[model samples]
Target: MAHEDASFTDISIQAASSHQVWDPFVRLFHWAIAGLFVANAFFTSPKHDLHHWIGYTIAALVGARILWGLIGTRHARFSDFLPSVSGALNQLRDMATGRRHAHIGHSPLGALMIYNLLVTLLVIAGSGWLMTTDAYWGVKWPKDLHEIAVNWAELSVAAHIVAVIVESLRLRVNLARAMITGKKDIRRDSR
Candidate 1:
């Protein structure tokens, strides 16, 4: 009974130390984009007005997010997570050596993935818009470009999920929960 109580107390202390990393706008943007993407990708008909509206919403959200990235909270800024060759190489070396560094924001490689997705989505939006324009109507290349971009974005999303799970296990961090609750349970020792 005493051991159980001690363990419970320890957990409480640990939880208390967890830091709020994701702000509300960032969290909302993450889940909203995910839901919108899934709806357009799986559930919605391409010819439906609803589908086009959803795509428009996604484009707007991404645009707003880009603006936020410039002037948002610490973890939400482009400056915080911009990818760098040297930084990515160092992160890769850490992975190879089994060294876990708990990042409060996106890591170097993760930053690259984020940028990739953002640009991909923007391309998807642009190509989609072009399809609606009279000049580009029935054009093969824009449609082809849009489809290719969608496929790439889907692949990137899958890879992102896998990487998140792998990193969470490796770092012993609840990253998904952080995105949900806007907090991360990073231990002092881990940092």
Candidate 2:
């Protein structure tokens, strides 16, 4: 009974130290892009007004996110999460040794994933836009490129989901909840 009480107390303490990491705009951007991506990729009919508009919106969101990364809150800034080879290597070492270095912002590998997805989104959007242009309309290569980019983006999103789940479990943090709530309940020991 005493041990359980102590455990609960520790958890409460850990929860109490939680802080807001992802700002409101950051969260909105994250989810909006996610939902919009799904709609355009699967639900929306191709070449229709709705699909075209959604694609444009996604491109706009990506542009907005890039701007935000330049001027947004601490965690949302690219400087906070931009991938570093040394940092990634260190993170890899930590993983191998089972060291829990819970990052307040994006982890090194997470940063790389973000970069990957952003570039992929741009490629997808660019190719899609080209498909509608007068010069490129009915062109086979642009369409092929667009399809390839979509497949790559989908696979990347899947990997992102898997990584989030795995890291959340490994680090004993609710990463998904953190994205939703904008707060990270970082364990004290990880600090």
TM-score to true structure, per model: 0.88, 0.88
TM-score for predicted model 2 compared with the true structure? 0.88
Task: Supply candidate 2's per-residue lDDT for 7.
Answer: 10
Task: For candidate 1, write residues 51-160 as lDDT tens digits.
Answer: 88988999999999999999998878887776677667766776787776656677777888989999999999889889988999999999999999999999999999
Q: Which runs in model 2 stand beyond 4 Å of their true positions? A: 1-16, 189-191
- Residue pairs in candidate 1 whose N, alpha carbon or C atoms collide under 3 angstroms: none
Report the backbone clash tally of model 2.
0
Candidate 2: tens digits of C-alpha lDDT, residues 92-161: 7767977766677787788888889999998888999999999999999989999999999999999999
CA lDDT of each candidate? 0.81, 0.81
Cand. 1 Cα-lDDT = 0.81
Which candidate wins on lDDT? 2
